[model samples]
Target: MGRILLTGASGFVGGAIHEYLSNSSTHKLTVALRRPMSSLPVTTTLAQIDQIDGVTDWSRALLDSDVVIHAAARVHVMQESSTDPLTSFRKVNVEGTLNLARQAAEKGVRRFIFISSIKVNGEETSLGVPYTACAEPAPADPYGISKMEAEKGLMRIASESGMEVVIIRPPLVYGPGVKANFFNMMKWLYRGVPLPFGAICNSRSLVALDNLVDFVVTCIDHPKAANQVFLVSDGDDLSTTELLKKMGRALGKPARLLPVPSGVLTLAATLLGKKTLSQRLCGSLQVDITKNRELLNWLPPVTVETELDAVAKDFLDKHV
Candidate 1:
């Protein structure tokens, strides 16, 4: 069994990775948290992390560790109101990452896996082409800018150190234990309120929790994953209306979609400053995983339909 150190063990993506890797007899995992975080399947306690300096104690965590998955990041909304969003993100995302990575390098950690978001490219999807792994990062928000900058920093670190850096930039992820907009959608759908996204035909790439966990573990051992940037998804696209319908079926409810035109909804949302919500639903943000397929010879095991169904059922079970 190989020992791995993970950060952000208490969050949604972090929790999923911990649970998934813990089940494997070949992997021994340690999660690092700033303080005590509960409601996790794994055991954890307070640990020391250097907030700054040319010196740090993080190398200790890297001792005998096989891989370091830096899942911890300053999420956008969590630190939105700060005076300098970019600087705040840098403090946690960039500086914190270097602290951990430098330690891993000193201690001879084999692989450094970073969980970066597709937002580094852009938040909205384009009409002609989907985002690819090679696309130049043009993050419009603070979160995206921080991640893109960190990628550069890690690259420099990897060149100097022997540790291999693997970057996996994934699009929107949804499934059981999902939060954010997907969770909000579930709540709206359960209320049987008619949604006006029926006419929107934008496509989005979504990865299920199970599928994302599987991909990350695969990268840990895959010889091709080293010094590589990869993009992963369920290899299928789903529209907003289709997603609602699938979710409804999983919850044993009917999708109440109104056949309103997309343009009309856009106008209404614009008037109310609900532009963000409208863009999210009607955005054609898709990711091209051709490189992932060719390089890793891997495809997601779970389908979007099955994943949405699971989410719906889980939501109802919790709320009902």
Candidate 2:
């Protein structure tokens, strides 16, 4: 059993990780939170910090920790409010992450697991040519660029301090408690809204919340995971049309999709200043997890169909 410190305990992904680790008998879990909460499990310890930034002190949280899972960051926002988005992102994602990592290293933390996004590889990929861990980074957005910079800084810290770093880049993660676009799609489907995505055949990879949490736990003590970068997914790719149809099946409401050409949709979206949203729906972004399988012999424990069904059920339970 090892002592582990977890950040972002209140977030979607981080909450799930904390729940999973808190139930485990083999590890001692301590969570760093921006504020205190009364609902946390009694087995878990809390470390409160004012905010995450370049100079946030993490010394108290790093005490006697064997591994640090850095999951909190300035997440990507569809409608960005910041005038200088990159600067805003750098302050949190880049500077904040490096600060925590340096402290972890100095405190003799064995491994630091970073939850990165697949956007580091770029916005889109060729239909059949998914991105690999070794691919050159071509971040197109401020959020992606910030994560890339953080990864670079973490690697430098690892080399100089001998603290191992494990980076996992996951694409769109969806399951219960999901928000953003995925949840929007579910809402549209449930409302029987007609969507013009029947013709969108571009493939995209997605990871389930359970699968991602499982992989993070796997990397905690897996010797082979040290100093490695991995791209994780469900090992299944789906087009926008296919994904909606499957979600519809899970939700007990067949999607009402109108067959619209991808080009026409792109043009309309561009004219309406929603080009990025269109690209997300019409362009392919796939990640190859061959490295994950070969290196750690790891496989996603849950299937997409099962997880999607759960997501639908959860949505219905809460919304209906």
Candidate 3:
């Protein structure tokens, strides 16, 4: 294996990938990021990739790589209307992606690994039905739409460029240094806060950071993964109540789950416009990593129990 070029080296997901490759391998790692790589080790080269011009100025990073993992993406969050999210996503996900893919073909890179999201399949995975690699895409939000568009674009590039492409779609990743909802949960659990969540028995797909990175590295050279889309998970689905309980267990506290009816909670959340939490609590989005496990012959290295404990210990140690 030759040098590998990774974009979005500073993002949460990308940084995890960068950390994994940086500390665990002898293979050359090249990163294209906005800020300097001084924050990173000296061995990691700081390659500048101008966002607006990377399409035309990719020779710097895509020149000598065995593969290029496009982890950098424009994540569309709430209240991003003025941002013209579709165009913003296209600038990076589609145009930037093709630009690098074409350059890789010209530069003779062997493979292209893309970290996609499960949202491409849809915002809502049917109850009791697991989303699979063969499921058709039905993105509901701008972010999901952009990821879907980029996936199609990448497929076209892979078709025309004669380079192997491995696409991975992971759902709800959590681990050490975890932020967003996961961090919020840790905060709440640390304070021994009660949750109105026992009555909810919905399940959603989630992957631990280590498992995600492990799969990405596995697909890097696994021939079976070439030009294929794989849905990945921790190989086990956990309910919202179960997740909170696990967090409590990890924090050495007992979960305070109220036995309120699921419908009442959904109604109250809807009225309060807290639908995001509503859906996650009462929704279903399980992924059958059967394809990933059987095809790539890979299973997640970290179990949910271990991952949850590690997350709590790391956060508690840092914040305490």
Q: Highest TM-score: which candidate?
A: 2
lDDT of 1 at 214: 88
Clashing pairs in 1: none
Error of 3 at 245 (Å): 0.1
Model 2 compared with the native: what TM-score? 0.99
TM-score for all models, in order of appearance: 0.93, 0.99, 0.95
C-alpha RMSD of candidate 3? 1.6
lDDT of 2 by residue, 1-320 (tens): 78899999899999899989989998998999989877767777899988999999998888889999999989998999999999999999999999999999989999999999998999999999999999999999999999999999999999999999999999999989899999999999999999999989899999999999999999999999999999999999999999999999999999999999999999999999999999999999999999989999999999999999999999999998
- What's the CA RMSD for each of the models? 2.4, 0.8, 1.6
Candidate numbers sorted by lDDT from highest down: 2, 3, 1
Better of 2 and 3 by TM-score: 2
Q: Tens digits of per-residue lDDT for model 1 on 1-320? A: 67888876777888888878766678776767655555544432234453432354675556578899888888867326888888888887888788778878888888999999988888876764888999888898888898898888888889999789999888888878788888887898888888877777878888898898889988999999899888788888888888888888777778799988878888898998888778888878888889888999888989887888788777888977
State the displacement of the C-alpha of residue 124, model 3, in Å, after optimal TM-score superposition.
1.8
TM-score of 1: 0.93
